[model samples]
Target: MSGARYWRHQDQRYNMAGNECGVCGSRFFPGKTMCPNCHRRSVGKMKKFYFNGNGKIITYTIIHEGSLQYRNQVPYLLAIIELEEGDKVLGQIVDCEASDLAMGKKVEMVFRKLGEQGKSGTIQYGYKFILK
Candidate 1:
């Protein structure tokens, strides 16, 4: 059986996210149904692409309150990363000291299991960032 089109479009290899526009030759991350520039819903998707997984921190915060899974991972880093592809994404940071957090700092992504999808479902694994 075929999976959801969005699931197939995301590059599991690198956690790259992009959506193409039918009205304009533009792309966006964190996939959506409509184009922001032209306000059109007829978006086009080309072949899947992998991101470089290296970005600079745009903005971030240390999370103290979160889900059960993140309870012990408090003071965790969640940041808006500006990718090399020119897309900004929100994701977690790992494998580095919290003191290293800084705007415009270089980061590299590491794929890790986010958590179980509710219960008795998929174990979602995605990319996370670490100081470079």
Candidate 2:
């Protein structure tokens, strides 16, 4: 990714920063300019929200074939996590084996190196989940 683009999303990638609707009390990841539920009422009522990163795995799958950027990390576990505050997010489950995971398992966010732009490009960092 370009430096500008990567830097632009630094907050959300590094901190799980999202947005909450002041009008209807709805929260979103990657933040939103307006709340879908409250619509017009949420036009200027969206506020920044920082997730606590505590959640549970609602479902999961083991990846034996990954994309070009993540091929080296194949055989990893990915899951749909239901955050404690109620937002569901997709994240890679690290530091554990597939045999160790199951639905409804507890997890917590951990900061780690996600990937790089290329061999000589930017080293991207982001959040990944680990068993609690």
Candidate 3:
């Protein structure tokens, strides 16, 4: 990602910041300018929401191979986590083995390094989940 774009999303990358529909109490991650449920009425009712980063694994996969940027992390765990607020998020699971995970297993977010842009470029950081 470009430097400007990365910085623009710092809040979301670092804080699990999202948005909620003031009209229906519905929430979304990565935030939304309008509520899908309330539509027109939600145009001006979206409010910033911060997730607590506590969730449960809905499903998961073990990566035997990864892309070039993440090849070193092959065999890592990735899962769709249902946050306590009800929004499901896809993130990497760290600090445990595959045998330790299962559907409905509780997990918590932790900040960690994602990767670096290049040898001397900016480093990327984001949230990863760990078994609670």
Candidate 4:
């Protein structure tokens, strides 16, 4: 994660989406290198965009056995959120109890420190789901 593609994914503000197929006017998230429907490799970067980062809880799970970085954060949530635009993504739900969460619950995105800053000592910032 030290090259062009690495830096590209590091842009957290950019909605984890932005792929376009030149062969078709289709757009995709996680930036597809090729079109899944048309099977064309003529893909290019689409305009960068951001979502409110707020969405509805569609599903979730609790992780017990995890990395040392998140082991203490146990009983943590890994949830599927459905954005306003219908795009769904998995994220960690913070600041609330699992009992307090449910399907169709509203969640707001907040920048959260993901792990021990990878030698930088500064934690990497990313999105988290909070009960709204």
State the C-alpha lDDT per candidate: 0.72, 0.85, 0.86, 0.69
Question: Per-prediction TM-score, please?
Answer: 0.72, 0.85, 0.84, 0.70
* Cα lDDT tens digits for candidate 4, 17-132: 44555665565444557667776345453433356566899999988877777787886889998876435778899998889988999998776667655555554556687898
Alpha-carbon runs more than 4 Å astray in model 2: 1-14
Of candidate 4, the 10-residue stretch with the lowest lDDT total is: 40-49
Model 3 ranges off by over 4 Å: 1-14
Worst 10 residues of 2 by lDDT: 4-13
Candidate 3 clash pair list? none
lDDT of candidate 1 over 11-129, digit per residue (tens) = 55545656556666455665557667767445453324456678899998988897787876887889999987656889899877768899999998777767666554556667788
Greater lDDT among 1 and 2 belongs to: 2
Error of 4 at 3 (Å): 14
Query: What order do candidates take by lDDT, descending?
Result: 3, 2, 1, 4
lDDT of 2 by residue, 1-132 (tens): 775466656664357788889988888876899888888989989998888888999999999998886799998899999988867889999999999999999999877777777667676777789999
Give model 3's TM-score versus the native structure.
0.84
Write down the lDDT that model 4 would get: 0.69
Best by lDDT: 3
